[model samples]
Target: MAFACQRDSYAREFSTVVASCSPAEVKTDVNGKKGILKGFHVVLKDTLLFPEGGGQPDDRGFLNDIPVLQVTRQGPDAVHFVQMPLNLDSEVHVTLDWGRRFDHMQQHSGQHLITAIADLMFGFKTTSWELGRQRSTIELDTPEVIPEQVEAIEQTVNEKIRQHIPVIVRVVSVDDPEVEKVRSRGLPDDHAGPVRIIDIEGIDANMCCGTHVSNLSHLQVIKILGTEKGKKNKTNLLFLAGNRVLKYVERSYTVEKALTSLLKNGPDEHVEAVEKMQKSVKLLQKTNLNLLRDLAVLTAQNFKSRADRGPLFSLHRKDGDNEFMNIVTSEIGTEETLIFLTVGDEKTSGLFLLAGPSELVEKLGPRVAELLEGKGAGKRGRFQGKANRMSRRPEVEVLLREALAGWQPTEE
Candidate 1:
């Protein structure tokens, strides 16, 4: 059975009687997120909606003002999934989303043009193809499609589009001899009725189930964006056709304008400007790290030189890192005094280090880590780890103070 969509791709509206309506659960994208759609599967006596098949998506439209979420072919019938159920056998007005249908037509037809030209020009048979949301891809049975070949194929495709050649759709019986003459990957086991063939007048004739334009000029233009590496020793050629090409150009221009303003350079110089900026940022980061290392040594010396220095010492630097904390501990020599060092935000997260008598450091490290909401490991006389609650440092200090009061150093 040939649905009205395949018979006349340009038909936008039609009247049909609902043959059946049943509860169904279909997968659909809701606001960019994938989710299950609980709906009713509607079958019509005749439908203008095209079901998903032959690498093209299903049609989106309306049935008596209710949105049709998806259309799928079940055996020989086109099943329309809708959120609201319609009374069975009721007459309903079906409206096709013209914009979506036309876009699919342009892309689908454009694909046939590119596929035919590639095969004729370079013996690159299309192993498979995908009609994507933004751009479509044709996977060629080859390892790579070089720039020169891409250019030639793209040129030929657009040339045919400009020639305004006629695109004819013919429906024939399954057993017809003409069916064997057209190109086909194969038909589904569930396929029934006649086979539909799409002929690009003198260019190519292939069996396809997707909707397409009536003439090559309807494609507007086809742009081969580039190629991507494909699996199983193949090359995927990326392309945009019709309005997609226009949208791509508009987006590219907008990005170029924004980059020019930010980089203070023309579009041609934008790449060079960004490269220079990255190099300068790297140099500045190196210089800042060197200064921090020197400051760490100075801070340690200041703590050691204190005339009233006690058995305990503590310091925190929000701008410092693990390397800075280790350097300060190294410079101060933690053999006599218990040292506590932290670097990063005072209220949130940071790294901490503790160094002192081997016995005392091991005992207090766990408790200190608990107060600071963290964990640490130690050996000999040094313990270090990351902390999540630097704001609780005062509590850790109190614990250290109590432990120190009861501690006695063993003679070495």
Candidate 2:
């Protein structure tokens, strides 16, 4: 289920893939040990067996012409599974996919840069990290970073990249005197042998098992994508580096170009243009509302010609806005007159209803709803519905009258 990229002494030969296998084609091994026979090939998983799960991705490489598809830990054993069939006991040439390996290196190194910069510039330490696709994150020792401070940190990291500092990798015994010189806070307790330390010259010296470039300059660039508040006293800083940084820069340029054209402004004026358009849109919205109100008054005057002076009445209007419905309903609804309006789209109808002092809603609303195969409910004076396929307003009017035949006024 996982691949382990072991940062072992054997890792010096970066091109070889190591794996473990048995001579016999056995499906299950109870002892968790495959029977050893002559000429069996072995592939090594990149992960440590005992440490188990971590955020690190597994190593993928080729073992003696067989592709080491994945690396996993089975009990105490780190198993490297191969993809191709191979002869038992044949000598194999192992090679890791260096592109993937280097990618992890860049990300891990970028994390060091960000975390170190946070501590140096802002007095914040990184508590954890999440390596992700397109971007990675470092959880800071503190809860929040202000915009100006974040910008400063970004500036600092980029400055370091430009410095192209030497990155030194040292394998030292846990009890070695040099271990005390390392500034990285935590070392895995389970590590029994020599520990690996990555030193970023004057910037950082941290304990790490992940592979890294010989120099910080290989990282090319470090970019801060964004940051968000995490759990108590923690903040997550998202970032990218190397090829990812290049891609991000390219994408940002493309977006800037599109925005410039849309706003009809040069790059320097685009931001101002966007703000101006936003203000214009708000003004247009207010003007539209005033126009709707005036139109509603005219619509109500036109509907007055159809009033029957009956206790319950209905009206229909084609292609009217919501304001027209509001004006008519508010004007005609009273103690004796119930009102209904149907607004139809191309394929369906919208019904707006208001009952008077009587419980005309209970009588007429359900009948109209059932006839149209719709659903609606209301209190003493209001109801609404969407009739899915009902097109004719006269049909709804007939159903409403029949349902309200015995309706009578009642006090609230």
Q: Give the deviation of candidate 2 from the true structure as CA RMSD.
A: 9.0
- Tens digits of lDDT, candidate 1, 1-412: 8899999999999999999999999886879999887989999999999999999999999998999888999999999999898998899999999999999999999999999999999999998999999999999999989999999999999899989999999989999999889888988999998999999999999999999999999999999999999999999999999999999999999999999999888999998999999999999999999999999999989989999999988988999998998888889887888999998899989999999888899888888888899989888888889899999999888888888898888777
Off by over 4 Å in 2: 1-104, 143-152, 168-196, 209-211, 225-236, 307-327, 334-377, 384-412
Among all windows of 10 consecutive residues in model 1, the one with the lowest summed lDDT is 403-412
lDDT of each: 0.93, 0.67
Per-residue lDDT for 95-194 in model 2, tens only? 6666666777788888888888889888998888877867898899887888898899988888888888988777778798878877665654544557
lDDT of candidate 2 vs native? 0.67
Q: Supply every candidate's count of residue pairs whose N, Cα or C atoms clash at under 3 angstroms.
A: 0, 20
Displacement of the residue 327 alpha carbon in candidate 1, Å: 4.9
